[model samples]
Target: MNKRKISSLLAVTCITALIVSGCGGGSGKAEDKVVSEKDYEPYSKYESPVEFTIGRNTSHTNNLPKGDSIENNMATRYVESKVNVKAKVAWETDDMDQKLSLSMTTGELPDVMLVSRTIFNQLVDNDLIEDMTEVYEKTASEGVKNIYSSYGDLLLDQVKVDGKIMGLPMTNIGNQHQLLWIRKDWLDKVGGKLPQSVDDVWNLARTFVEKDASGTGKTIGFGMNQDAMNFSPIFAAYNAFPGQWIKKDGKVVYGSVQPEMKEALADLAEHYKEGLIDKQFAVRSDEEKEALVINGQAGMLFNPWWIGYTNYKDSIKQDPKAEWVAVSAPVDENGKFKTIRQDPVGGGIVVVRKGYPHPEAIMKSINLTTDFLYSLTDDAVQYKKEHASEGLTDHSRWNNEPTQIPMQVDYDDVLKRYYDDIMKADKAGSADGIQEDRVVSYEAYQEFKQKGTAVDANTYGEYLSRIEGQREANNPNLEVIPAGFYGTTETMKLKWANLQKMEQEMMLKIIMGQASIDAFDQFVSTWKKTGGDEITQEVEEMSSR
Candidate 1:
């Protein structure tokens, strides 16, 4: 119920996407003069402003300055001023998938939209999105192009159908694997070293609960929500990647049904039965699970590096003694911390409606925004300085842009840069070559060092996530296992929901001691009989292509 809790939940969800011949919509004239590829420029400003309607997918908190709306924020104004393109918000909603489904049913779509992978494929199949192959090549800035290329063909290839790029895929920030986050203070009090293996993690959690390290009788050893337990570090320790399509014996297979998963589930069941995990986790909301950590009722969780920027920051604010530290942990028998690599391309792709005039405008807007945000140009550098002087750090404004290929190229490398250039440099806090966008966090790190326990929550969060959390994310012993596939198959569309529901129910039941470990085998059998086999075959076929 806390405001920070809402913000943290929104932060997790905000992270996200066009048409064609055989496309679903009717052909229409260009809204502006169509320029040839030879005449195209990445930052070309149109003589007459090109206006496009956007079905904006927004976050719960825009954090805009007074009198500024999502339709006319700093990002929108910058795009219009630089590229002479006006973005009109036809409609905005936090639930883009639902809104887009309604739009598809009504046969009315905005000129542009950021859609999920499922919706993107649907739009392409319906032939309702624009082909942006030429537009991207001609109108994307060098930096934007470089960002896409950094992922090699892994990203762009996903949006390519019949060798034509149909939509722009959003590049994910790499190294988003879960890490073991534990209260260092609690571990110290409980008299245990850092956990090195699954057994060690269990012993430590048991110790924390048995000793009541939180000093509260209701202390929870491992705080987790219903679904999140599937992706916990413990599963990774057993080399089981639930919710992912993984390669096994060179065959694309569903991870949840793997033999390794049964072992992991059995371990989780044993732990749950022993009261190491939160007893009410199966029924708790995300906020309630987070409350365990934030309110000092839990000492550990498995989350990405960004947890420092979310729940733990609030925890520190409430209790300055709460010292959260991250480790790439619960190593397997081989002493390697293995984690599944998420799909590098995000869930969404940015697509323009079929027959929309000037598809190049989308690329142009993306180029301008990328250049400005990264301070790649002189004007952008000056703008960055001005914005910093104005004390504006509300990054939610960037989401207001009409079209974007949101990317953080070499994201993991940023931590290396911070370490080499800032942390271990001759000049302690000099941020000479760091990207302008990250300078704020650098400043926050400096403030955190100076202010320590008295530092504000925002400053503490930046330091924790960017510095401490990232350090663990860059662990040398971490084994990164790539997902076998990221796209949804046809069978998945019809049966994945029911299959996933059944899997979730079975996993939760087993963990809660309601169902025996043998239930996993039965669930697998039912899953295969009821479309799981078909989905796996489809996944193999797609992967082969």
Candidate 2:
């Protein structure tokens, strides 16, 4: 059949099936059977097994149990047993981006693919992905729906292409806030207080460099990666948020080309001139910069709170006294600690092939895994026990298909619940009223009682939660992205990357003392002439609509 005929046939079949066995009785006729809600519950197993193929990122860190492959792991087995869906791995590559691009170019995408926002948008544009509107509504459980709904209209709006939702967005909370990860031990050794302003940071970085806090005489006062010059937390101090659109005088403007950025660049240039920043930072990879922190060569780093997991874990293991703490980005002129907030839409999105037989399978799998991870049922308890030591790596990375609830989603709420309900009880040596989700926090609390700190990853994660919660609760000056900033404009696909490369080059050149600050003005002019103006105009149009 042709595409139109196939679409028409599918539409009729869907309508007929819905009328025969939907929530509402069809004309109250004897031919139609209205089922109870329990019959449609998300957790129930399929009557028979179904199968699909998918692509996956085969990271080396995914340590599966003995004799189990990614396709046949415990999590996959559990999913198959529960949902009756067997997910075969069609392809595996550590570089998901490159692999996905190759698949797209070859017109051979899997039944489902985990993809970043840009790829998802491109797939939708090419008409290679399914419109998941009906399947999601029909299959998503209350918990899964609630999680997405809590993100507000931004989640709904950004995923839509021409009024149709192209993919399911991952859910996370407050993961975008830039934090200053200061080494507390070094701070005490240098007798420097936490930075409260731009000037304070300048002074602290100078002192840290002068004091040779690394103990190897090669201390880097400010740690930075290649992307840092553009996305650095220091920009927050100057109220210049890069990689976003901001409204100024009732018009959309690109953040990187704003005047405030010039000031930030000037300040960074001064830091570089004084040797406070690593002179070779422009060439350092993320792993190398992370090592600078982990090996005690960098006194201060700027990134999100999750850096604790990526960079600090090994350092803490090697040196128990190397304490890292997350602090708010330094205060702006108004005595407010300002930081750029992320678009609430989480990482990668989940997309289905254009003519996939079982579009609802993706929704069902997400609903099942989310409930399995968060719900306190007997099965969920057993699931936790089976994978407690290895964590949820298999479920999240392999079986969940694409996205999982972000690592820091509802982090503060969970932490608050721990303190309010589980802390005192656990301190008194009782486990009553403690939920499964808070079990890890309970363990951390016990460790805190015994060792004056939570040492392991899970336990230390809880410790970081307390600090983040307290900081945000007490003082939050987060500059959130406007509703429409996250959406991609047509020109962005063609020119945004080039624009960002130009911005990074110019910004780095100024900061490295290779180009004068005057270069910023000429670059801004070139930016507008080359496509920034058109992109800004498109953003304004979208925001208005």
Candidate 3:
């Protein structure tokens, strides 16, 4: 974290024991740290508020201007007070593809937008988004630079197309660690220590499902069926990553057509026949599945780090005894685990509108947004500079409030450094040891390093949560995968599209036994014929860069 020797007029000497319980504290008490009724002028309330219309998508929460939401009230008000930039949501949570495509065709855009990698590429192709590279170079702080240094190559690899990195991609603090996410109460009733190895994991699942160890007749051992996310954790150890990696010679060769997929399928099919898997996962919607977890029908589930946050603040509100801990994501029989790194620039919770009046304003907004997140949590920056990476955090990301780090950097060494430092600082009681913007970041680092193992979930709500014996996330010494080249040549695009589609469809079918693994040979033949070969050649060329 960038240390500026905080010289603000608002400085108050923070107490150690006092700040420990930042959450679950009284809101209005003098001891309460919550910013309550502070008088301030908002940026959006300018004489003619510098209108910055933004576009976004929302599923879990409404992104539009809600009367009582923090975005509308606290954060928006905060932005106005601090930056003097009037920000308003123009459009949110509709078909983004259609909106962006129309905007491109019509030459109409908001000031900033949150678009997918594909949309970002299209904007680059059409010369839409202003380049933030120079802006970041000139105005960005050292803390922000640390973020870039960690994921800079990743952004270049995925978001940067045609020699320019267009938009600033949002990032996650950490994700993809295998979390067991098991019911703690059930374990107490079952009367046994946590499992240690793959065999132990299996035995626990079997006993929970068959013996009804938790005394909750409705609950089962492992609560998953067709969920690629939850189920993949257990199988990741045997050199078989969750879905498919499509690798050749040990580098991800897209496992759909690879022979190892047959192995994974056979294992899954056996579990399905044995009744260890969830019967309703196939039909359950996202919300329904979450219900299954809350209702205690399943003792274990799989999920990313964010889900853990909801468990504490949201889900636990309903079931207070429901101590959801993160168990390790399962490892393959050979003690192997893998994660398919997501493109840092692809997925994000926030996006700038395309037609906002000022491009630099968008850059500043992004910088501030990330900085705000990092400051509160302090993950991206801390992990960027930390060394001696070990351990995991006990707290959730929302609670820690660090600047978000993209998941692609989760297992990468570049980030482990930051994580290590943040934890050391937080545990040492020097909260201000780093920048204030990194609260979440430091918390995440500390959660993993200190308390991660203290709270393991049946589902992977947090990375450090332990299952029988394993932590939800992987710490295997693996190399970071290069970001896949987006927006290739026309022939390359067509062929790559066809090849990937064919591979995905065929792989799912083969895994479900709807198609035979033998179909792979046929797939290989068609892959070459359908421009897979050309795309491969193109990818090979791109990789050389």
Candidate 4:
């Protein structure tokens, strides 16, 4: 953190505010002596703008069209434009885990670093990051002030650690909810409405199997990438959100230990026994489940809205008639299934030196990033493909594209709205990699009430992998789980595992009828006797802070 730079930044903001507000005194000609308004100066005046060296995790340099890659990629550039300062991003690395760790070890942290809560904690514990509380309170401009107030508790909790605010945490934009995507055409074939209740879903899966709605006689009733990370939506179906680790009721609990978790597992085990789950699922990477779905070998999947655009639609090019639709994930009749939201913590914390330059710059970056992603227009065409992967033998990309924002959920909304506003934009005129003449099949679906069924009318770009028929298409679904809910402290981390494993293990056991639901009581007792007390205490303390 540069002290002189801080002085300059504060001075600049003060003077600007004064000059703009002070002009009220006279005719305001160049030579007119203007009385800057302010019942009086509340604090300091603006100093000359200074230069900063920012470090980012990116794939582009800061000299492309939008602002070169750096200028365009960060919202901080908006800050620069306002403060009349310039920044030279000293380093831009794509692998945040590797780069930040390396940078921390070398004691060369960026003036501003973008990272997640876990990493932020590690950095703070190591005494490598600065606290930004004063800066936030004093320097936040009007726009910066508003966002902080809007995000409120969420923003406050993310940056605070051990009762201290250390950095500017990233915020979630767009649809931060999960939705289930199912093949309605198959549902209709099975003489069923889309499954709504958990039991209803199971019954429908059985029907699909009995009837082979896909006509291939090989459709798996359900398919999901087996990664524990991607299991939130499915877990939600059973009323569970398995964060990497958690603390409940004051004890460290693990996901696998929960009795409900066991029930969930047993449910999975049952599906496995019935061959309703993808047989290859255990070994299937995220890529595999995706490929299975778009190829029609799997009729169901759990993923974000963008999946339809980037995965299924991309793969369906191989078979033009391939169609898909999305709906909110199914719940139990109690409507109490698990719907895991982001862990209320995310992206490593970004911190500036205590009393360093542009206190509001970090906040400005967040604002800019959000607006850039959600407030996109035709002029923003440059924003897309900033770091697009060129279809080739060797994959390469840069952080120069707008679509590169992994969470640009608004794209899903805009995509549908645009295509719907004028159907011609997507009519057969340009399906890109989409299957031509699929609408003819879709029309029949309409007669049966499948209008918004084909993901998003037609696809724009498509790609397929041979390993599995996983396709990438233009139909982007915006539904995604919340971000930043994974940053529990060390003690909570321990209790969370014990708790989760208890639930996970028991879920499988009960569904197998191997353990009766009555065992849930015993499991809860075990949890309480374990470290549940400590876990809950820590979580409650964290929330209070």
The most accurate candidate by lDDT is: 1
Cα lDDT, model 1, residue 538: 85
Candidate 3 whole-model C-alpha lDDT, 0 to 1: 0.48
Those runs of model 3 whose alpha carbons end farther than 4 Å from true positions after fitting are 1-53, 56-74, 77-84, 88-93, 161-163, 184-193, 216-219, 225-227, 242-247, 250-252, 285-288, 310-325, 332-336, 346-358, 371-545
Model 3 lDDT tens row, 359-474 = 44444444444544344335334532341121113322222111111111121332444445555675687656765534545454445556443434323233322222232343
lDDT of 2: 0.66
User: Per-residue lDDT tens digits of candidate 2, residues 155-269?
Assistant: 6676777677778876555544667777788899888898877888778888888888768889887866665642455786787877767777788777888999898889888
- lDDT by residue for model 4 (1-545), tens: 11112234434443453345321111112233222332112122324443445666665332334333443334334334443444556576777767876655444455566676656665565544556675566544444445455544655666666656787654443333445566666766667776566666677777877788777878677774444435465565664545434444554444444545645655666776787766666566767777776677666765554553366665455454555555554655455434434433334455663223344444434333444443332222233334332221122221223222222112222233333423442354443323222333223323323322333423222111100112111223222333323456557556767666775565445444467666656776787678766665565555444
- Summarize candidate 1's per-residue lDDT along 1-545 as a digit string, tens digits: 00112233222222211222211232244453467654378877888777777776663534556666655656566778887887777777879889987776555677788888878876676566788998888888887887788666777877888789998877676677788888899988877889898888889999998899989898878876687553557898888888888988999998999888899999988998899988998788878987888899998888887775686688877788777788778988888888776787665788998768778888887777777656667776776566553322455323423233232333324455554544643255476666555677778778877777577777777777877788888788888787889877778888989999998999889988999999999999999999999999988988887
Question: Would you list the C-alpha lDDT of every candidate in the order shown?
Answer: 0.74, 0.66, 0.48, 0.48
Compared to the true structure, candidate 1 yields what TM-score? Answer: 0.87
Candidate 2, which ten residues in sequence have the lowest lDDT sum? 22-31
For every candidate, C-alpha RMSD to the true structure in Å: 7.7, 7.0, 14.6, 11.4
TM-score of 4: 0.62
Please say which candidate is ahead in TM-score: 3 or 4: 3
lDDT of residue 456 for candidate 1: 75
TM-score to true structure, per model: 0.87, 0.79, 0.65, 0.62
TM-score top scorer: 1
Alpha-carbon shift of residue 191 in model 1 (angstroms): 3.2
